[model samples]
Target: MKREGRGEQSAGPSRTEGLEEAVRQADPDRALCAGFLPASVRADVTALLAFHTELTRALAPARSAAIAGPMAGLIRLQWWRDVLEGVRTPDHALAPAILSALARGVFHRETLLRVLRAREAELNPEPEVSPWRQMMRDGAGGVQRAVGEALGVRDEAVLTRLEASGAAYGAGAMLRHWPHIQQSGRYLFPGETAALRQEGEAFLQSCDADTLPPAGRLAALPAVLAARDLARTSAQAGQPRGLGDRLAVMRAGWKAARMFQKSGEPAL
Candidate 1:
């Protein structure tokens, strides 16, 4: 997983731009997908992704230690949970935008809480693959559904497909991050790398991207890119970095847009 940055610590809306930029830098894959969203909701989608970035980064310091590190991460997680629950006003720069999205009903509050809880599970390093699997399903899967809903996908089948594809991408990402995470003395998905990789591949094999609606394809685009990387790399390989990653995302987006355009659906 990419390390999340400590975005501008300021509280007001004035610093929102800086925090959003930091999120863009830290989570380029989702941010790149967000760019393909309709202009009406593009910024809101980025705000939702910013929340994801904050949760992932919160665990950075804890990756090196077992107990105490996770404890510290829990405190950070609680602050976010409380902020979302309205128990306290947000003290972070990205909060305003997130709150605005919430106010506009971009995604349900309970759904976001599920994502938070899923991430909370990540703080405690587990020896079994089940915990990590649940994390990906609820964490990344929930995020894709939320973003898809924000993009005007209302069908339950489409939402389910989005969730499945996103979870597969999460599995791929976990595979990519396994080596680096192990170096930190933590085993997030201990002993199941091969099984997980197989699971992701199976999911992708069944997911026909050409049949998905344009919005659904965009929602699952990261997984498409991840599948390509997995095709050429080993279980321990890292995701495409920097320029290569950007070009890969751009090419995928263009191809997807063209496909949808040919089908008479709106282009991505």
Candidate 2:
């Protein structure tokens, strides 16, 4: 695997400043990903987050809603697809930061294409209520696989295991961001976010110390099951359907947590 140290100083002043500014603008909640990765990996991950932030702005909800959700999302996806297909080059909005990373091999081109395809699928998926679930699962898998491949893990078993764990973790994170998705009138599952957060916390706590690496153990320390359970229960109070929904979410989280636990330590 490539082991380059953080090389921000080697980049041009403008590029360095832009990356730093972008990182400064990054949402703290999302920035938590840094804790899960190595320093070099964090740089790439930060670049990915910057790309996502720019993408979100470029396809702002107000603009998307104006153009209509389906059409807008398709247009955005098509833009990226065009870049992947070599039909067009990156434009100003996505060019500097996102495309620069692509050029430098921070992320694979095919993985970007997969992300666009997944977004396209989400725009018009089957089983309307949960359209994003499968697309998200596949998209996350593709990116994770790309990352693992880039890291030079050729063993198929190891690759598959890493992909699965990464996908589940990605899905869990996406579940937590449901409210943002909802603003675009794209719902993955009713009450799924709350349930996922609730159950995800539980599953993390339930993990035995021996099962997790030191980093994982430290990462899991913040959200014990009790805190999340109380938050979920409190939110659901006086609403029977809310209570039921959270229970379902908790079940899903439990399943995810168990799957992640069994997947063994991440290769990172």
Candidate 3:
């Protein structure tokens, strides 16, 4: 617990902008899609994504046994909890951005709490698809809701769709990183690979990008790309995405941004 916000407050805007650029490079697909959003909305979304990145990195060392132990990771997780609870300011590079988002009321505390809860569960993973699915929904889907709120979208129906999309994207990502995850000694349910792919495909079939509102469409970018990648011929885990794929994602993002500009807000 530290009271170091005075300096961060003075440098918040520039530091947050830097963090947003880092997030964009780290997660290009979502970043490309997010580029279509208004500047303020994109900044909020970047802050949310930065928090997600923090959670993942907090556990990485322990997961790989490359640093201290699981206890070290647990401590890191608790630090975030303290920050979110206003117990103290976080001591991390991403703190300024996250704090700025909170100041603007762009983030949902409950949703972020759910995300941290889900990440904590990953330390000792159960070898079952049911719980794993729940984790994906809570972790990734909660992020979607937070971003939707940042975009000024308060519709429950739209949020629900975004949740499902985020879950599907998370599943697809797990499948794509199967080899790396297995190398980390994490547990995966027997036959879960096929199940994950199936669930992702099912979501793809049901998702209608055209039906999403402009802001909603920006929020759905990662999921849309995930579905398309999973549907590729001979697709499998650990396969590298090509230049063609990047181009396609760019095209979709451009189209979505244009649609958003054309239609400010529609009742739906």
Candidate with maximal TM-score: 3
Distance from true location, Cα of 233 in model 1, Å: 2.9
Task: Give lDDT tens digits, candidate 1, residues 1-268.
Answer: 1213343121234535665577678887677866666555666677788888888777876775555768877888899999999898888877776765666566678768878888788876576766766677678877887877776677888877777777777777767777765666543556666777786776566455557887778767777656864554445445445576677778777776565456564311
Backbone clashes, each candidate:
0, 0, 0
Model 3, runs deviating above 4 Å? 1-13, 66-69, 187-190, 205-207, 233-240, 266-268
Residue-pair clashes, model 3: 0
- Stretches of model 1 off by over 4 angstroms after superposition: 1-15, 65-67, 205-207, 234-245, 255-268
Q: Could you tell which candidate, 1 or 2, scores higher by lDDT?
A: 1
Question: Compared with the true structure, what per-residue lDDT tens digits does model 3 show for residues 1-268?
Answer: 1324553242336666687678876666566666666665666677778788788777776767745767777788899999888797777777766766665556667878888877887876777767876777678777876777777778788877777777777777767777766767665434656777887766554445558888787777777667765665334555656677677767777887778678775311
The pairs that clash in candidate 2 are none
The TM-score-based order of candidates, best leading, equals 3, 1, 2
In candidate 2, what are the lDDT values of residues 1-268, reduced to their tens digit?
Answer: 3435443122234544566456555533334423344344455555555555544443455344755656765676677667656678656443454555555565567666765666566555576434444464355544454454433345555444433443454445445445555555553543555655544343333433224333332222222222333343333322223354345434534544454446553433
- lDDT (CA) per prediction: 0.70, 0.47, 0.70
Error of 3 at 113 (Å): 1.7
The alpha-carbon lDDT assigned to residue 92 of candidate 3 equals: 76
- Which residue pairs in model 1 clash with each other? none
